[model samples]
Target: MKSHIAALLLATSAVFPALAQTLAVKTSAPERYVVKKGDTLWDISSLYLNSPWKWPALWQWNPQINNPHLIYPGDVLSLHYDSEGNPRLSLAKGVRRLSPQVRVVSDKNQAIPTLPLAVMEPFMRFEQAMGESDFDQLPMVLGSNFNYKMNIEGHLLYVKGDLPRGGNYGIYRKGDAYRDPDNGAILAYESILVGTGRVVRTGNIEAGKPSTVKIESVRREVKPSDVLMPISSGQSYSANFKMTQPVQAISGNIIASSNKLREFSTMAVVVIDLGRKDDLHEGNVLAIHRQSPTVIEKESGPSYIEDASSLDKVITQVSEWFGEENDEDSVVWHMPKEQVGELMLFKVYDNISYAMVTKTRQPVRVGDSVSSR
Candidate 1:
């Protein structure tokens, strides 16, 4: 019994020393870290942690860092120490220290970075700034006695003399026509028609005399006996007002021919009436139309929705060409070797040849009749 007790006491003394040594090592463990300039928490975390993304975990441990963005120069980092003096990350503020600035150097020569051409290709292809030479030259019908009316505010106007009213009238605010009393042949229309105005109030004034009229906002000119009517109101009329500018028209068939061929696709390409003579230039858009395609939806099982199918090819691109005046067989400039889908002529040639597509649910095609929609 005495020997056993003595052995037990010796064992206890040995275990106590080992445990005390571990406690002393833990108490004296150092976890101080210095912060370096240009060094981010991310870099530091990446150096210490297995994953750089684990920086957020370190940030959460540090209550001083309210946000990732809060980290700045001179911030210290602290890690906890185990009994074995091993470094362990912790949120405790007392464990970390601030250090000196860290430096990073590049080994390779740095070259100025430039954007690749492919990156800018789309912008270079942008057709927004294209010229409209042909459209400026095309002959456009001004408000004639046949097509348009003029109105001042909301009132209509009537012209005096034997002139015909209610036709396409160039709504000028000031100028008028003088009739020869002897022969009554239509006299000269005024050259200095000041402004384009609509005739709102239409009534008969004495021949060769000025009539009471609510002309369009300003004073211009009115052809005596000119067709005077109120301008149509609303968006369509507004669009028409803008359409007073001349545009090109597509002529001939939009099909593939060996002689006049340009580009060809499963679709068609039509010839534009305006060309170099008409001042038509490259990158002009022409609208084409065909019959509207039929759409049908298919049926699947109870839980599934079926897909819808459509018939007919759509208009795609427009190419330009020039033809000899007397020689119908001559070819000027064909864009594609064969005709493909027709293009909408949003652009114009120098001859004032230009147009826009109707862009309707029904597809437009060659010979379908295209006007400024």
Candidate 2:
């Protein structure tokens, strides 16, 4: 019995030290820091903790008196140790700018955002997903005013279809279909927003009357082939962003990105296969793990080769020497996927979510899988 107790104590000591290592505070961490404008959650968290994503663990939340996630400029954060000997951070009340008329300002406006709003701007509120049939049903740009051969911003347009009076529409072109890499099943169709316009006059196709619209903005030249979708308004972005892990384990692949670049780094927009059905919500931080591009290991199924172009070049050279074309058979050692970066889910759909690459150790690519582990 004494031997068993001794072994148990040894195990307990080992486990606690590992836990402490994970929740380790950086040596350079500040004891107390004043929150300032233009500060991000990662920035402030990194000032006191080694892993910024583990910030909630360090936060000493007071459910009754404070909203731990909403910290504004001028707030004070102080480091303290809990009774259990784990490090914790406590927040002090902060102030915000008031209206000249003494009106109560919104807490979100004063609260520091989770990330730079500029990094998430285009992907958060602007992106829209639609079915292929819905894309087909949208009204097409009929022609431009004054019979101009090309259409640009601030030009008038004629559209033939049902349109609501005073509705704003985005002129779009169909983009790539996001498909699950595991099974070639399409998850969602991407709608690329190129231009926008406001309805000046509603139209009736049967009545032979076309709707009049004034183009307000254009990313690409407005064309007749583009489809019109209503500019979605309301609750697009959240200033009170909080980082939380998903309720359960999530495994999905990186299907697409907003910039269309093959290789991207921090602040790039990425789309994942997991979504509302997977119980993922906004501000959920996930690890982006991909197999190292330099190493490809033998596996039962196909290997996940990220940054394939570079990997292919390496394999091609090896093949030339060995006289074999297959890259998989050339490599025999196993390499587990390593965490290259982290992303925070900002927007979620029925079967997909939009995330910003918040941190990176290597350039991330489209085929890399993500985990909520």
Candidate 3:
């Protein structure tokens, strides 16, 4: 019996050594620091961590700290020791009591108070169908030949042409003058007018024989040897103008917007009417209006729908502003889709874009009127 017991004890001890080694290797070390006002997780990671990408690891280690991105002045960070004496990060409130060996450094690099990224949400501008009057008039090719044909409506004139090596072409209608086909210059459409047309398609043409071309439609008459080239589609007509900088309404309107109210997609782009001309610039923050509920009462009998109580919501939340001038009419705003919301602007642009809500908790459609606070 004694010999048997000794053998069992030896086997148990052998298993214990393997488990111990595994536990020791799995333990992690703790890092502690004192939080100063204006210190953000982004700044702290930049200071200590070898790479800023490790910020998520630091955040996970310190789960107690709410709003990891937001830190107040004078918060204490402690590293907790595991059973094996491994250090792990921990957060504690109040003044930090330091030991002699630990040195506290003054973090001068603080985070600046700015609007959240949610405000500059991207928006999609669905292109309207091209009209007949918007079709190109001239058909010119650099190296390759082109086949041209008119649509049944007589509004559109299509051209099929192979582009020269690295050459491009744009389509334009003749207004009041004729153009010199060889020199690639415009004389006049109808002898005294300039022409305009909308670009229906864009693509690269390989150097080769011309392909079949068909004009979808046109608004005016088209002639042969018209000029075709590339130009900007046009300016966006947006009523939505998000304020980038704060404005003290001495005598104008004050607008606010929410990031949740904007609809943003990968290719979507939002344009605001505010810009340098409107005294708005980068690093500006603004408050957005929360959507409100609208209730309609029944006058005589039962309503058509079941739930007569109309659902209403308010737009609340502040968002940061980022974007540049889009054109003479508006400024382009770009942000991720998740952050779009309702916005309110204190002012409006004269004959230009206005701050409007493109999305809402409820059915907020285009052309809805928005006011500033």
Best by TM-score: 2
Clashes of each: 84, 0, 56
Model 3 whole-model lDDT (C-alpha atoms):
0.33
- Which order, best to worst by TM-score? 2, 3, 1
Runs in model 2 with CA error above 4 Å? 1-22, 62-66, 93-108, 146-150, 232-236, 293-331
lDDT of 2: 0.77
Residues 174-239, candidate 2, lDDT per residue (tens digit)? 888988898898888898888989999899999999888899998988777678878766645575
Best by lDDT: 2
Instruction: Give the TM-scores of the predictions, in the order they appear.
Output: 0.18, 0.76, 0.24
Question: How displaced is residue 369 in candidate 1, in Å?
Answer: 14
Q: Model 1 scores what on Cα lDDT?
A: 0.32
lDDT of 1 by residue, 1-373 (tens): 4454346435433633343233221333235444444443334544564322223223323444442223344455566556756444534454334337644232122211111222222222221111223223321213333334533333434444232333223332222232223354323222222223433333333444333333444343333443222333321200100111114443432321112334333222233334456433433333344433322222331111122211101111111223223123221222222222333333333322223322233433433433222
- The candidates, ranked best first by lDDT, are 2, 3, 1
lDDT tens digits, residue span 1-373, model 3: 4454345435433633342233221123225567654444434544544323223333323344433444444556664556756323446645565769755554433332221212322111221112224334334422212333322322333344432323322334333222232353432222111233332333344644343233333344344544454333453333222222244321122121223334332211222333345443332222223223322233443332223333211111111123222233221122222222343332222211223332244443222232322
